[model samples]
Target chain A: MTINASKDLYAAVPDEQGRFGPYGGKFVSETLMAALAELEVVYSNLSTDKHFQQELDHDLQHYVGRPSPLYEAKRWSDSIGGARIYLKREDLNHTGAHKVNNTVGQALLAKHMGKKRVIAETGAGQHGVATATIAARLGLDCVVFMGETDIQRQALNVYRMKLLGAEVVSVTSGSRTLKDAMNEAMRDWVTNVDNTFYIIGTVAGPHPYPMLVRDFQCVIGREARAQSLAQTGRLPDALVACVGGGSNAIGLFHPFLHDESVAMYGVEAGGHGISTNQHAAPLTAGTPGVLHGNRTYLMQDSDGQIMDTHSISAGLDYPGVGPEHSWLKDIGRVNYVVANDDEALRAFHKLTKIEGIMPALETSHALAYAETLAATMTPEQTIIVNLSGRGDKDILTVAEIDGIVV
Target chain B: MSRIAGRFQQLAAQRRTALIPYIVAGDPSQDATVPLMHRMVESGADIIELGVPFSDPMSEGPVIQQAHERALANGMCLSRVLELVQEFRKSDDTTPLLLMGYANPVMYMGYKAFADAASAAGLDALITVDIPPEEVDDINAQLQRVDMDNIFLVAPTTPEERISRIAAGASGFIYYVSLKGVTGAGHLDMEEVTQRLAAIRRHSQLPLAVGFGIKDADSARAVAAVADGVVVGSALVNAMAQTLADGGNSGQAIEAVASLLGEIRQGIDSAAS
Candidate 1:
């Protein structure tokens, strides 16, 4: 589906108040307002500073492995018999995921702000590992909050964070998942606002966070736009990425948002199914509400109590999506769909065996939807799927599912 | 004047600081809230800040967070909290009651609808912690339409410019979070609070009520010396939790909480003298 590019969609968004058309705003306690304002000002200045840009670009290229390849999955595409599938290889980046891109940027911002400590909330622990990696490099103290359930599921990443000299706090409150860890992180930031900077993992949270994280992660789309033209002679027909707070998806979609000919899809984790009401597809099955400092699509009851979400992939098991995705959904600019646990597992194994590439279960959700979408298009059409992370961290989860002790 | 403003005026006239006590509705049990409110008022609570239970109360420490969990387990909700207000009003309409919680519940019930329903239920003010000054305009407008006051929090980290802005927009009284952490998580730094309260006073003439870490009678007395009102939350909730854990019935729990409030009230009165 083509959009009308006559209007400049990018220039009008997240107005001065940080609102994405009534979706995104600083819906946090008074204690956080000043810090958010300070961040907004500092980011606006440093985002354009020549020296800061050079430093960030240098770090991206040398440290985090920027310009990850756009490899065409010919065998997988031929086996499926449809659109030519190309994977934006973010899994090849340092720390093995797209998460490092934003972390590297935010860690630099933290250093520039003269903060001595940094804190982050993680689900699936990929973000925690990435944050720890950068903080170790920068010689800043790091604390990562992970839910107890996630700590058990992603032990490897937790140990990796510890080995990197970061403290991992186990959050045992409300649902024992991503949302609770975020709550703990917010509390910590509120308390330590003076000496610590919070490095949020997704395109969510209050103002400047969604904007800054998106800006940092947009490298994915920028590189993909250029790579598609250079390799395939033109931009791909479609872009696909999974939406857990929608960082990876937005990173791959934002640069192409105004490209009228490019269709974009954000896949949400469907734990059981929408019918069973046990999924985390807020954009697909939830309503607009405030949570974790922003107004966004949330999985909540009628009484406004946030509901517990379920997903095989810990990364996608959140009750709310980023507010920008809420805006994108409202404007019909992106199609938000769902892939269930079983389907994601199928895609996880399919890519691992068929292409010798093991995709993170979170990324497998996107691959699941991509397979269905690819089956409908002609071979001439090309689809770019964001391989968000490597599946190495998910080995334990997969093994446990198969009832194996290992 | 609204009930909240009138009460503050009366307290100022008597040179007595207002004693505000916060409790989660239906914490011990759904049937226990209205009685607790009445008991608190009798025990010398000038204003009642009833917590509307939310699944995620991020601003609360573990003490109040557990209270919210217990309340939710007892099936408390926004509508029920309003119903409790109406129930409390049935016996005594003089003591001002305010709903204190997060913003999502109010957002769930449309702003106008919530304002109308809450005002009709005899609520005097609203304190949704997560809705800061920048985002309170629309909801504040709705509350104004219903003649209800939209209260705001002034934190220790709040700058003077933002404080003035918040003071300009806020009605009723301004709530001063005395520490840099979540509710019930920090020790009261009396000097810092006094300094911040003095700073906030320069920006607004409205009465300032201080909360967060005003736990026992001693802490309440210390804060009362510098502010127009002293608000206690986790201590009262903890008292009730202890009563329930010790196998005390809801009545005993109410008695325990009321006893603590009475001591706090005495502390405030003693500070005034």
Candidate 2:
């Protein structure tokens, strides 16, 4: 059974040192200490600046196409007791995912800071593609590191990034996937800090990055709040989104977190089931530890070495989640759940056949959970699902599983 | 404060460039690395970067990766590497020691503990191969709280704006990759290194050390003419590899590499003079 949410969801571990429940703290060589201190100052200043917010808002609205619409799914809603359902169309954003919302904003910050190049790491290539798209727009040189294994899987996205004028580096390292890509990108950023800006894709990484990316993505919630209120006269009962690094989910859930009436569910990628070793559900079956810069729940071995996570959805292949989501789960602001591969596949086909919308496999996980949710709830309840990205990239994946031709 | 940074500032005030050297630690083992680092310091190394081995080094060339693989096989992790540094610290605490490695093991060990142990082990700085300058403090606050230099890398392909941002976040010395590719690639544009280093220096006063292709005394001396320091890795590793291939004592191979490093440092020092 899930424990009651703690009043102080965030347990103190490191005092005044930014440690997260004994999971976070700065561990680095002395050479980079002053740089961290300086970064802390710059980040704190940027966070409080109204002008920065306005500038980001202007870009998000016009350049990246903000205020994505919420569509009421009449057909899907009817099948599930005719309950009213709304879909937050973050999948419609430029670059075909909600990642652009944060990348464009962060790249703009880099430009404002007088930085010229942008760098990032990607697992499913959504973040890399998004970062590359913004770098092209800003006329900045961009580099994206992807795991060598992922390069073979998501080759189409790699080509798309190259087309966007971003250099895609194949990182052939440990596990040869997302984690290795992260390592390579980090190395590149450290090596090229002189004129480079790292656009972290998720709500992971260090404090300022997690906070900064969340703030940028908060547009999803800000707009969803206004749109939901206007369309339904109130907020939805449940907010559902897949939790691959927890960016899109947090984007929608952050604003609604404080609203007591709203319940949030984050669907993690459970490849087979929670019982199997092959799952990406870190919070449910994993422990609190560090991975990819932030101290959070990670799928790791007892020795604390990061474990290679498995997920049918390439985007949800990460072994860790955003630290904020971890805190939110602990505090009962959100309920973290898992959707298996078969369930996700069923949802993918259901949405594709019923609504004629083939969503990204990552989004299918949320839809799968929604299916279970709708069966138990009455028609009066409303569910707002975050369609994080389009399924164009996953055509090959779905085809292989379904035995369809390319 | 980085020894190279102080020296570079002095050189900047007097219109001079600095000289640096790079080596993969535990390449042959402590028998060679301990003395080799000392010899590099003695010869004329303004700063020395000691690479900690990992299972996979993405940015490194075949030569350097081989060296890393060998070192890993020789049982070199963060603790062992620090022990190597501690051994070197007995005679040369002032020569800045930069421990460059991946973040997994370091993060696994705990950030605060790693920082405390590294600081106590007498490390002057760190340059994680896969950590962005902005995210350095995520590991442990002590990396900055203890006033250690977090060196940043500046590559030939880096843009002006990024250079400024990295420079702003950089302390210790700024490492400038001499080429666009990984280490051990026999190609380098010395002119490009000079130009990129100059471009990076415009945004930062930190020492600019060039690496990735300076494999020999000649190449090291050439890069040192325009850069604050020269880093030689693959060439040294290659020489050591050759010795190991010959069934020669691995420690002797390290000594031989150190002797070559000393030659390169002397050559650069003479050229500067």
Clashing pairs in 1: none
Residue B51's C-alpha lDDT in candidate 2? 88
What docking class should model 1 receive?
high
Residues B1-273, model 1: lDDT tens digits: 889999999999999999999999989889999989999998999999999999889899999999999999989999999998998899898999999999999999989999989988999999999999888888988998999988899998999988999999888999999999999976789999999999998989999999999888899999999999999999999999999899999899999999999999999999999
Worst 10 residues of 2 chain A by lDDT: A6-15
User: All candidates' TM-scores?
Assistant: 0.99, 0.70
Give the distance in Å from residue A363's predicted Cα in candidate 2 to where it truly belongs. 1.6
* Model 1, C-alpha of A75: deviation from truth (Å): 0.7
Q: For this target, which candidate reaches the highest lDDT against the unseen true structure?
A: 1
State each model's CA lDDT, in order.
Answer: 0.94, 0.77
> How displaced is residue A341 in candidate 1, in Å?
0.4
lDDT agreement of model 2 with the native = 0.77
DockQ list for all candidates: 0.89, 0.11
- Candidate 2 lDDT over residue span B205-263, tens digit each: 87777777777767877877887767777777787789889988866676667677777
| Over 4 Å off, model 1 | A1-4
Off by over 4 Å in 2: A1-52, A78-84, A272-276, B1-235, B241-273
Error of 2 at A15 (Å): 11
